[model samples]
Target chain A: MSYFSLEYIAMITGFLLIVLGIWAILTYKNLLKIVIGFSLFDTGINIIIVSIAYVKNSTAPIIDSAVSLKDAVNKIADPVPQALVLTSIVIGLGVTALMLAYVLKLYQDKKTLDIESFTDLKW
Target chain B: MLYTISTLILSLIVLVLAVIAIIHKNITVAIIAMGTVGLFTSVIFLLLAAPDVAMTEAAIGSGLTTVIFFYVLNKIKNHDA
Candidate 1:
């Protein structure tokens, strides 16, 4: 594979992220680590989306008066992925904040952050 | 070529960190390792051409999450044992 090929690079990175995420979930007994694993998984999905939008030899999707609109369109990067990434970022921030708040509350009530200590709710 | 090698190295680093985080007896050290994994994942996001995602990963994944973990650690006693 070519060293600079965007697709190959993206695929490898995404795959690695996924594997790390799963490992995090399996190996960590901490609840915080499970959340981190989910975050890693989310990052991998976002990367895959953006990678799918990549086109070989494409330029940024900005319109320029010097270039014909049709020609510019032909070489422009996909805008959909950019928009999706923005949405995903906002959602991620919201979720992380909420999770943190919950963690604080859990610690306050239980006086412990260890997942093993929180056996009261277990079925 | 370069991208592949860099991604592989970063992945290996993340995996090692995750293992250390899991095995570490110190809760604080494990939490810090989790943040390191987040930082590495953000770099991978950048390599995947998702700058926005990378920014979010760095901010929430590393910054807010680490802070929350630390806060919980402080609130709880005997977490390291």
Candidate 2:
């Protein structure tokens, strides 16, 4: 397919991910679901970043004899998204782990996992 | 044109699943739906030429997160006391 063709698909998918993220946050009563929603939001943003880097009929950013080094570098995909995804993935992992640990602590303290059951904290 | 139409269809499917996840009363179902959302989102990332992001989403978003959610759910389930 064409380059823009891929981008168009990515745009639509990114939009859907955003909508899903909102829905997850708004309707799910579970704290875990909320955390998942945040991840979903992150996924959508990543998609947007990748789509923005799309270029027409380009190869990987590797030097080759078939194409001059300058041309290869010029047509190479943006490295920015790759870097961003690396950071985001680490962040996502850290947050999820922390959230799970908190959930365990909450369970131990409250003796229940239902968020609605933890009404004691509220003033 | 064909590509656009396919993308639209996939997007619509994603939207419908998201709505279902939100409205479902069963928390388990909602969590599963969230996993589905992650799967589709990764697909979108792949389409967007971000294989790195797609890999991360697929591994962490759909994989580890789901396992953690299920583990927590089980803990709560068995200890309903």
Best by TM-score: 2
User: What local lDDT does model 1 show for residue A96?
Assistant: 65
Q: Note the chain A TM-score of all models in turn.
A: 0.85, 0.80
Instruction: Tell me the TM-score of model 1.
Output: 0.70
Taking chain B only, the TM-score of every model is 0.92, 0.88
For model 1, the DockQ equals 0.32
Interface RMSD of each: 3.8, 2.9
lDDT by residue for model 1 over A55-105, one digit each (tens)?
665655566774468797677667788678768866875786677668667
**lDDT tens digits by residue: candidate 2, A30-123:** 7777766776777677677777776654444445676577677666677676677768767876887788789788888977656788887698
lDDT of 2 at A115: 76
DockQ of each: 0.32, 0.44
Leading candidate by lDDT: 2
* Steric overlap count per candidate: 1, 0
Pairs of colliding residues, candidate 1: A3-B1
Spell out the clash pairs found in candidate 2: none
lDDT of each: 0.70, 0.71
Candidate of highest DockQ: 2
Error of 2 at A6 (Å): 4.2
